[model samples]
Target: MSQPKHATPEQARPFLEAFKFFYQINDASANFFMRNTYPISIKKGTMLHKAGDICNHIYFITKGAVRGYVNDNGKEKITWISVENEMVTSIYSYYMQQPSLENMDAIEDCEILSMSHEKLNELYNLEPSVNILVRRILEKYYADAEVRALTSRFSDADTKYEFFLNTYSHLANRIPLTYIASFLGINLETLSRVRAKKRSIKKS
Candidate 1:
């Protein structure tokens, strides 16, 4: 990740627009938020938040992708992949100020907008509407977490692959297949076979 710099109006628009989807933000609040948040550029393969490190801020992806994963006895177990126009962070660490258990890294070179925990809290206190905005955002995060947890338990690799395709088919050609296989909780060989089967079915 590169050093964060103050965001220009153009850079801040997408971040503000993402928030507007959850809650109404008046001009004053939008201006204040733009002033507080910063822009960062992350190189592919760079770790934004690492295990055992406290996550200091939450990030909004304006471009590219990030993946959340854990090192399980030297193997990577991918938990989630977030693309542009989405929020990405070490949730537990960001909220509780504890060390993160997973790593968040850039899967592709990325541009992101970020606001520190301290600045966010200040917004909550100073602008009451910001509380509603954050609550709505957290609710969506929790719902997505629940869905991911349920999906991870699927026992059939075919069913898992189907679900992944339904949700992330757009990313299939963009990201590494190894990362996609890990995210689906399937071995690479299994994923390849599944893809082959899908292709053959399409041709028939």
Candidate 2:
């Protein structure tokens, strides 16, 4: 693992802006968070955290993208992909303080700001507003997870693909098709066929 460098307020601004947009955190609280964060740069294909590793931090992507996946019987099953201005972490491991079941890696060279579990917890205790922000952030993550789970369970392949496109349109051209196929619970051939069909329909 590379050493984490301290983030300057300028580098932390985008992360704070994201929180402010979602949680309405004030400048003072945001500055507190900025002061506590560390900056890290990861190259494409670098695994930030792997299965069986403890997830001690949550990362905010200042730039680039990251994906979460699990190795299932020699196949990589992608769970989620997050891009710039988004947060990524093995929530199960971070919250439970156990070894992670998922692997998180950079899909593109990334600039990230990270906050440790210890500092996050301390912020929760030291700042009442921080607790509200944390709760809302967790709720948002939970809601998104639940929706994705339900969609995968009930939606057809074409419908799933459509949902994937709609939900991750920004990432469509950025991430590999194989990862997107796995995320949508479809095979690569099927995804290709679906794209071909859509293209033909558009031309007609």
Candidate 3:
């Protein structure tokens, strides 16, 4: 996640729409916990968090995509991508109560609902059902992270790329070539060559 957090200009609409239903937030919980909920929109390539910044909010993407990445010597590497109907956060920093070392960013123009860290925790503590919802959401992130780790170890770059394309087809057309290369653990040049090869075969 990035350092020095800043709030977006508007509330995220699509996110809140889907999320309100996904979590099944009844009138009681909605009135009590998320009364201030609203929409926030971010353009592509916007940094959600910078290195060394504390994560104070959880972003639920209702539209577009989000990714977590790290930068070293001007080179950016993508570690995770969260898309529509998914939750995105700077995990280590948010839970550890420290500054983040990585960065979270938007890959496409996005609508995300930002929920305060403290407020969410308070709701979880007070409501048992809400607590379960929060736990399930966290579990999703954990499981996805594990899948990515396993894929990195057991698959080759081309296989990984193909898997990513087939599985997250919604993302295939929206992402940039550089980020896709980074996600597949292949150099951009290599990815370019592969794309060219595919084009050549299609033409033939």
Candidate 4:
């Protein structure tokens, strides 16, 4: 993959906004966070972090999308997709300071602001509010992971597809059907049939 381009401060507003919104921090706090951050723009297909790599930073997407997946016996199983204004990180690797089992890659040309784990730790100690924000973010991440796990185990194929559509409506037409199928734990042919059936029902 080609090296990521450097992003200018003017191109970083959305990232700052997202950070403030997600963390519920004030402008001053957000500015402080941004000051310690770096910006990078990656092309589609760029791997942000591969399996077994330590995720040293958390990324705030200003543009484009990212997907997280794990390879299972040569099959790629997608676990999550994040789009513009969202954050992406390997939670286990970031928090535990260990190698990750998941791989994260850019699905579209992406501009992101990133903060290193070391900077995060410094902020946590310097600002009590940051500590609270981090706690809340972790809670949300855990809750979301639990929901995905339970849904995959209990939901039928159609139900899973429906949930995926609702969850990633913005990406329904943007990402490849194959990736979507993998994420929903269905084969490509099944996904095609499901889409055809839906289209037929709507046409009828």
Full-model lDDT for every candidate: 0.90, 0.86, 0.74, 0.82
**Per-model C-alpha RMSD:** 2.0, 1.9, 4.8, 3.1
Tell me the TM-score of each prediction against the true structure. Answer: 0.95, 0.94, 0.81, 0.89
Q: Put down candidate 2 lDDT per residue, 41-153, tens digits, no spaces.
A: 89999989989999999999998989999999999988888898888899989999999999999988999988999989988777788888888888898998986786588
Which runs of model 3 end up more than 4 angstroms from their true locations?
1-23, 198-204
- Rate residue 20 of model 4 by lDDT: 57
Better by TM-score, candidate 4 or 3 = 4
Return the lDDT, model 1, position 110.
97
**Model 3, residue 64: displacement in angstroms?**
2.5
Q: Which runs in model 1 stand beyond 4 Å of their true positions?
A: 1-4
Compared with the true structure, what per-residue lDDT tens digits does model 1 show for residues 13-101? 88788888899887878888888889889999998988999999999999999999999999999999999999988999999999999
Which residue pairs of candidate 1 clash?
Answer: none
lDDT-based ranking: 1, 2, 4, 3
* For model 3, the run of ten residues with the poorest summed lDDT: 4-13
Q: Over the full model, what C-alpha lDDT does candidate 3 score relative to the true structure? A: 0.74
**Tens-place lDDT digits, model 3, residues 1-204:** 754233332333354355455477555655544454445789988988888899988777878888898887898878888788888788888888799978998878988777778877777666667776667677767887887776566356667766776666676777888888887778889888877776898899
lDDT of 3 at 198: 67
Better of 1 and 4 by TM-score: 1
Best by TM-score: 1
Q: Rank the candidates by TM-score, best first.
A: 1, 2, 4, 3
RMSD (Cα, Å) of model 1: 2.0
